[model samples]
Target: MADNTAINIENIYKKYNALLEGHFLLSSGNHTKFYLQSAKVLEYPQIAQKLALSLAALIKEHSIEVECVCSPALGGILAGYELARALGVRFIFTERVNSEMMLRRGFQVTKGEKVLICEDIITTGGSALESAQCVAQQEAKIVAFAGLANRGFCKAILPNNQKGNEGSKIQAQSPICKLPLSLPLFALANFSFDIYPADSCPLCKDSIAYKPGSRN
Candidate 1:
């Protein structure tokens, strides 16, 4: 993939029918004009392999040494495993046990191990951060974060901020993301969609918000 990966991402998403356009109720409780169902694209093993190799190339180009790939559970498992295969590294994952990220199933990371957090999509970076925190608890060094798609949300504030009302928590991804004005969010492509609060959402006015995610 080239430096500008968004075009390639768009092409792949379209090819795999991973991109959906409509009034969507996101997992975050916000609304958006578009949704990226990455599972559609990754469902094919051959397709997933190709995408992971592309991401591995990007990681090599950056000279970042990743000893292993760790992903947040459920969604990130396939991508992370494929990426680890491409990178020739070990793989492990963190899952939500009681809504908190935990390394169960006898998974363990060694101290000072260089780790890369992988995800299918990164929107708020909260889940990725939680997984990273899990790695940190093992004294593992978080090299960086990689995702198949980055929703490109680094800065901006909303009254419905799910994490907290902490005003400046958005800019922390600065050092982490190579995308324009985003952090730690290395992705195969970037996506930016207009999200809205419920009261101000135009879809809510039309009474046609559709929940299109598997979790729902």
Candidate 2:
């Protein structure tokens, strides 16, 4: 079972609210009542240290025997580094190269190595899945996954029972049978379609001021 110490959903939310800003379209494409500006926390070494400690404690408690830690580039980079430090292991990240996410810059995962995938947040699990795929290509075993906030969607569960490939493709072989967070899954599609291109967005149609969402 996963440890509960690192999965502080409530504190994560409070910290998020403190850092969030104006109307934003999340990567999930949902109009969020809240946005998790992870960079705010990442930028503060003290806060980032605190979070890293929590994640390290959880790894110890769970006895997760991972050889390496991996995360998607950008948002997951900081957290992944912290977790790796806590675990005393090597850390690597996958990045989008020419529109596809892959492990570049000579990053290698030896076959049969145990890997723990981490993320800052999981809205649709797209980026994380891509990183997982890269790991799979190296024939590594993804022992488990960690995230600061799960936001209720199960990347393990597809909308139509479709199997999502963990590494090669964004499909899963089975519903995530195990996830640390316990929240109801609300389809991103169920929320109002508030996202729009610069010119065609409904917010623009109504003259609502737009705030730039984070690209990192």
Minimum summed lDDT over a 10-residue window in model 1 is located at: 156-165
lDDT per residue (tens digit) for residues 1-216 in model 1: 422332367778898888998899866677888988888988999888888887787777667799989998878899999999999999999998777889999999999999999988877676778898998999999887888876767542212212332332433443333333332445665577778766689877767788876456
Q: Per-residue alpha-carbon lDDT of model 2 for 1-216, expressed as tens digits?
A: 223333444455466564453455665443443456666667777666666666555555546688998998878898788878767899999988787889989999999999888777665666777788899998998877766554444543212222232321232322422332332211111111123334454444444543333442
Model 2 stretches astray by more than 4 angstroms: 1-21, 155-216
Highest lDDT: give the candidate number.
Answer: 1
Candidate 2 structure, TM-score to reference: 0.67
- Provide the lDDT at 4 for model 2: 34
Report lDDT per candidate.
0.75, 0.59
